[model samples]
Target: MVKFYQHTFSFEHAWDNVTYAFWLRYPNPFASHVIGCDVIDRHVDPDTGVLRTTRLIHKQGVMPRWGRHLIKNADAYIVEESEVDPKTQTMVTRTKNLNHVRVMQVEETLTFTVHPENPKWTQVKTEARIVSEMRWGLTGRVENFGITKFMDNSVRARKGMAHILERLRHNAALAGTPVAAAATTGAPLDC
Candidate 1:
């Protein structure tokens, strides 16, 4: 079975600043479950000037007691692919878990664009698909649990992004620089 979810939200920050902050979002206070993030590959297109990146993320996950029998550990490895088109002021990202698919698999896509009504703000559209391949009555239970957990995680993830964006805003004000410029300084945002 496949379960789907979608959400639309806006950030009070500009597209450039929001996209820049996305690269620095991992170590934010709201995302303590994320243990590690490493860039697997990254490059800027010479002709298009678009930035593309692949990253690996390690997250300490929570699994229901019943799920313990299906998987030995709750740790999850995720692969993320992202592209940022500076010219178009748009960013798109897709992520999926690399482990524990037999129990459940959740895939999510996110798009960031300049807000139509407010140029200074950015709009984010999130879409997710949850699937479980288990046979028998266990499939329904697992997929239902997957959707519930997904919604909970989504809320926390949004808070994490907002937390990172606020820090960027603060840093920009403190340094008397653009938020994007502050984001480029490679400072760790770890709590």
Candidate 2:
């Protein structure tokens, strides 16, 4: 079975600074589950003037009591691929957990673009898919659990990014430098 989720929101900051904060978001307080993040590869595409990046993230997973037996140790590694097009002012990211696939797999895609209503704000779209390949009648249960857990994680992830963006704004203010992509609260829609 497969489960899907989608949400749309805007950061009252610029696309540049918001994307910058995204790169620095992992270590924030809201994401304590994230232990380590490393840039595996990064380069700018010569023709497109787009920055492409790959990162590996390690997270200390948390599972429900019923899931403890299935996911021993509860540690996970995530692989993330991203593309940032400076010319177009857009950023796209895809991520999936590399381990514990037999039980459940969660794939997420996030896109950031300059808000149509306000150039100073950045618009964000989030989409996720969860699937469980398990059989023996466990597939349904696992998929359901996956969806719930994924939504919870998504909330935490958004909060983490928001925290990082705020920090950037505060630091920029302290340093007395113009924030290139700083964001503030904007019209947000979650569904």
Candidate 3:
């Protein structure tokens, strides 16, 4: 069997401007002129296969804060996707690995979703999963084995975080938007 690497980053927000930028920058070859961001809630019923919450992000000027964050993550994060013999009933039947149990596990699908909130916001939903008839590992990444290392210590993390926030704040100011007075209160842009 062969495996290929696929990288994907998705940002679903309510900011039309940000959505415009995303649609313009990452998803397509053309650039967008929209601004602002918001969240889109999609309610899909697995039992009935009914899908709802079909929202579209549309903006033509400056984007929202969350949108900016999405852009940043797209530029920095490292992602990869590949296919394997997903655990399915058919797979187990053909592999001859197990037959006495009368169970079959075939191919599996893996996907990782990372959404980092603002610097001020700490909690986030970072997920790595396999979607199939059964569940798989939800384990964390191994230590010292990631894409890139930006910081060496708490000071570095704090400093890096501050620099990122400062850049966002600066961009907001440049866009003629009301700068969050407390956005860079103590976080100096030392990078």
Candidate whose lDDT is highest? 1
- Candidate 1: clashing pairs of residues: none
Clashes per candidate, residues 3 or more apart or on different chains:
0, 6, 27
Please list the C-alpha lDDT of all candidates, in the order they appear. 0.88, 0.85, 0.26
Query: Per-prediction RMSD in angstroms?
Result: 2.1, 5.5, 18.9
lDDT (10s digit) by residue, model 3, range 1-191: 11122232333321222211211232221223223222334444565443323222333322234334323322111112221121210100001111111111112122212235432222211222111121132111111111111112213323333444444556667877633443324432111
Pick out the ten consecutive residues of candidate 3 with the lowest summed lDDT: 88-97
Clashing pairs in 2: 12-183, 12-184, 13-182, 13-183, 13-184, 17-181
Looking at model 1, residue 59 earns an lDDT score of 95
Residue 146 in candidate 2 has what lDDT? 84
**Candidate 1 residue-wise lDDT, 1-191, digit = tens:** 69999999999988878887788788877788999998888889999999889999999988888878888889999999999998999999999999998888999999999999999999999999999999878999999999998898888888998998898789789989988777668775232
Residue-level lDDT of model 2, residues 1-191, one tens digit each, is 78899989888988988888888786888888888888888888898999899998899988888779887779899999999998899999999999998899989999999999999899999999989989889899999988888888888888888898888878879867666623322312110
lDDT of 2 at 3: 89
TM-score of each: 0.93, 0.92, 0.20
Model 1 / residue 154 / CA error / Å: 1.0
What ranges in model 1 sit over 4 Å off? 184-191
Question: How would you order the candidates by lDDT, starting with the best?
Answer: 1, 2, 3
